[model samples]
Target: MSTSRRTPVTTGLVTALVGFTSSFAVVLAGLRAVGASDTEAASGLLVLCVTQAVGMIVLSWRYRLPITLAWSTPGAAMLAGAAATDGGWPAAVGAFVVTGLLVLATAGWPALGRLVARIPQPVAHAMLAGVLLPLCVAPVRALVTSPWLVAPVVLTWLVLLRRAPRWAVPAAFAMTMVVVGIWLARHGDALDGPLLPHLALTAPTLEWQAVVGIALPLYVVTMAAQNVPGVAVMASYGFTVPWRAAMATTGIGTVVGAPGGGHAINLAAITAAMTAGPEAGPERERRWIAAQTAGWAYLVIALGSTALATVVVAAPAGVVEAVAGLALIGTLGAALHGAVTAEGPREPAVVTFVVAASGVAVAGIGAAFWALVAGVVVHAVVVRRASGADAADEDAATSPSPTPGR
Candidate 1:
């Protein structure tokens, strides 16, 4: 095959490989945190893979653009940090459904999209950073507790970070697999039950707390961290994403997969560049083929979801979390930078970050929801005072009395 044809195929596979291996653990941790059983978490993983695959295939083929979909990684981090809801797994599933509907509504209602866009960027980033804090420290915690298992994984990640930056998380995960294999060998008969992929669906039951605590925060995070950035990434590569179509596809996919434990799906932010950029091919028109190829590749990866979950089930404590932490370290850094660097909202952003990282639940609601509330309140007060001060200064300068006094 010629280089043009091969590039799309190869890059498509790489994009899928890197995207899936790098963060699937985070998805599992999120589902588990929100009260999913091991089987249910595995089901979530499998269905998320299928839903995103379909979304990518349909969006790319229809638009003739390199548009790939992914599970909302930042939203997952929020889930990992969230306090379990009063209604348990069913409530979490309900929250997932609500998040999907909100995404769909955002596509249908221009005002809704505008409302989301109005959120201060610093506050949003601070919320994400706060949610990621505990997870990002897992490698350090794991190293302190289980150096034998975690040391090699961290070393592998560090070495790869300097050389092949894109492959760092995947390589660390590969090393973790080696550690899991060793653990299994030492403890024979560790494997149990079914290893093949299967769905374990939950009937969603809406609870007010879940809606307020999980669904609302989840919708905001998915929109701000994944969908918006994904559009920007594609645009940076000279591809204009069809916003409504993209949201409709991802929203519908999220709704369909909710019963199977998938949290949410949205545009691929990190992998979008790989699929849409010049790396896919010199011919811009043909890059859509790379996303289509990646869609098919995800189906192949889905076959291993159950086996991967099985290892996670049997692996030593903190091992999977260590990998998850390493995968998120870069994202945490980016979120923190975005949180602190905004000129006007810096103080309010810090307040948001501190509140979120506190992990304090109030009246059955998680800290994430409260963090946004507190940040917005502080922002309002600060901005109001600043504007008032500016107006007073302007009035004083223009006043006739000041000229008479001089």
Candidate 2:
């Protein structure tokens, strides 16, 4: 028997599985990069998956919309090499809490969200592209370093992309799995880490430096990079997003997951497209089934957090990075196109991209925040100059007409 609320089982399952396999490696690698212990990273991964699944179920059920919630892939990317300037992982946890609160505010108060909405999209897009630049380059570097393992993965991705686009990422993952199996067979499962996940909470600590350096940037980037476009995606699919409800769910979810090392949660853009679109089903109203089913499927996958984390921890750094980077290539290209498509803001967008991609930090803050600020400055100056030129032209045109009439 099937429910009207759930029509596509296989679609939902694939969405959930691909969502985890394609990016879970990046999430673990990011936490480790930001100084989290393996156990802590495992906890974070499990908690986040559970949190997002719960959120997706809640929002989709309540609103009767195919609202897909996701742990912010871009946020994790931003935090990849960022350690708390003040208290390390605990401080990063604090930043996560702050980011969640900000997201809540955006949902609860439409006015504030509208303010965020007013931010120029080009700047946001530029910052996002810059943030993803290094990770996107990892595949090329991996090929240079370890051609044997990487060639197959990259080749599978390209061939599948041409042959069966939807299967490309999954095939890449399968190739990696084959490699993992070979490695594990050589070294038996005698690892000290438990196969099952156990959550360990880190007490949140706050410092001015942490707030400015980690918390602020995390909040802004997640807002611009994830949440803003997320709702837009829903709207494009003709679903009326209950702003407060959507924001509240993610904010609460983030708070719950953060203490367990989860970074932040937001509405899914890419994954949402998969689950909410026509490919999920022929009927638009019934597509909610896909998101709902995918939500449940994610919960099932969450059970293997420890196993997933172990594999990521054991894999060579280049291999982990290469896989993660390849997964994000499409995202990087889309973001870059968004950043530079408009003639009006091209300069500012470039400024933002360079500042962010350069990875320059100031005071305790990471490059992402400074990148936004730099872009805004450049945008303002250029707009001002253009405005002045327009004014001058108007004055000259008016004076010439007056002289001719006289």
Candidate 3:
């Protein structure tokens, strides 16, 4: 009996850790890339982890579905863009709240959620593929810069993922650390930096211009780019949950954690789908319970200590980047396959992919919004015409039958 109960719990915990470690470095790197001070970045990560865990727990328990929550990676990427413009941390927090509200609002409207649900699978897959493509490309570029450091880790990750899917993320992370540690020892880089982790808190202040202009756009991108695709991924895995409730939970968590410096909280599409899919559990319903457990565990990690952030920063950059890229390979491949393979809608899907990949922004809106728009328009024009033709044929087929009966 003890072993029976312990087995699922252990598996759940290990699965959560895989997701946590796989993306944790990217979260930190995103914070740093956006000009957050180390203290601010650490705080943001803590808040992010906490909110993500809470949302996952609440939703998973209520719906009894393996619904995992996560910070919007696209939102993080938006921050990277915002950071390039010297946006302040407070502004970023404000953006998170605004984005949370937008997600909440969209989720609140059942019609809108249904409408989003109506988006053709191909386009959604294309968008997902487009969003993740850059991540896949990044590791290869990083290898070029630090082949000695990143090559072994990447090769090992590929091997482990092929042979031991469950152990892949943790194994790659451990291997990367070993390689980096060895390199540092040989190169004599400072092994001992500040052992004590730094903590700082900031009061939330509203910046209307930044909120409306920067924050709003950030929210839009996070939802459209991250959350929508997340829903699609879940559906693909045969786990269906109400979009509004998911959005509401995500929003509430984001709002709660905003003061603590978290960015947009949204459904985790790719990684969560990977873990909660049939691969993670024998029964479908059990996966939701696992996700809820993961949420609670994440919250524990968030509030526990600064040691977490310290360890993350101490890891070699190449190792972290390579691991992230490698961990996402499965997801990236699925997204690519889905995006490029839709019947009769290939052109529009391809258009969406290219526009999103362009990374262009206009009037503060991110590329993702535009990509959706462009794809929708093309699909509407093309697919609508095809539908009309089909309707006309049906009408012609039945037309003389009424007259004969008369």
Candidate 4:
């Protein structure tokens, strides 16, 4: 192949590796939060990670856009909430299908897509910040229970993040493994387990209650709270791709992976932005190939679920938390700046961010959806009134015939 083609392909592989490594901790946490049995959760995550990688590759290749696919982090939170109400794996999958359909529908309708696009940047940023705040807090909360285990790891992560942002995660993981190994050795914990691989397949079962109660809500949260912003992030990076096609790719991936208990697959915004940015490559156009490489690498990970989960489980919790938090610092700061910097929209954006971070759930919907609703109402009332007043003044000035007659 020519030098130009080879460069994208190489950069694409590197992007995938970096993206997957950075985000894997979050994925593992999502699985555990939802109470998946060790084996089942491992299998499900394997499916999710692989399918996402594949979808990213296919879509990037097709559009020649630097679009990277990832499992929905916010969607995982919705599933965690649903699981709290006794929704099982089947229910989560059901929710995935519902959300996939919603995304598909949104993409199919040009008017709706336009409406989604028209949401103010401040509002979108607020929503993104709101959705991510909980994730940042999860590790801190974990620290309360396991300070001995979590503290050293977290501190190491912070220092590494400050000194070497790119290597922070991997460094934290290494430190965590060392800590765990030492602790295990001191306590004489058994390290013996089947070091062999096992394969288990789960067939999809339809559950009506799960569909309505769990699946629908999850679908809505994933698409609205997660995927929409994902598209916006891509656009911000100067890559404009079709949302409909991307959603369709996720839907099809969900369908394909459903039998193995995968929930949903979608575009990754924050993490993708990290890899597709100047950090990953010298040339802009080569970024798409990075996403493509990530997709294939994800498939390799899926095939090795047992080994991967074991590694994740073995890592100290603090290490994962601190690294995830640190990696997200830049993203969080950007979201906050966007949310609060706008002159007229700051109040509404603040409201959205607070409501989203409150972790409040009413009628089974998450804070992300509610935040958008609240912000829009405020924007409409405030912005429309100002617009109306301006229109009235213009009308008064232009009323020539009445004055002339008088």
Residue-by-residue lDDT tens digits, candidate 3, 282-371:
666666766777787786677642555665566666667677667656766776787777668588889888876777766545555567
Best candidate, lDDT: 1
Which 10 residues in a row give candidate 2 its minimum summed lDDT? 1-10
lDDT of 1 at 42: 94
Candidate 4 weakest lDDT stretch, 10 residues: 191-200
Candidate 3 or 4, higher lDDT?
Answer: 3
**Model 2: per-residue lDDT, tens digit, 1-406?**
6543344666788888888887887788777766689999999999999999998887787777788888888888788745436477888788888888888887767787777666678888888889889889999999999888788889989999999876787788778877766666777744557579779799988766667766676777777777777878878778777778888889989988889989988888877778777777778877877888889998899888788777767765577788788888887898899898877848999999999898777776778778888988998999999999999999888884445555
Model 3: number of clashes?
Answer: 2
lDDT of each: 0.94, 0.81, 0.68, 0.66
For 68-100, candidate 1 gives per-residue lDDT tens digits of 999999999999999999999999999999999
- The alpha-carbon lDDT assigned to residue 169 of candidate 3 equals 70
2 or 3: which has the higher lDDT? 2
TM-score of each: 0.98, 0.93, 0.77, 0.76
234-321 per-residue lDDT for model 4 (tens digits)? 8788878677788788878876765555667777776667656765466787777767776777777666656656655655455556
In lDDT terms, how accurate is model 3?
A: 0.68
Tell me the alpha-carbon RMSD of every candidate.
1.5, 2.6, 5.6, 4.8
* Global CA lDDT computed for model 2: 0.81
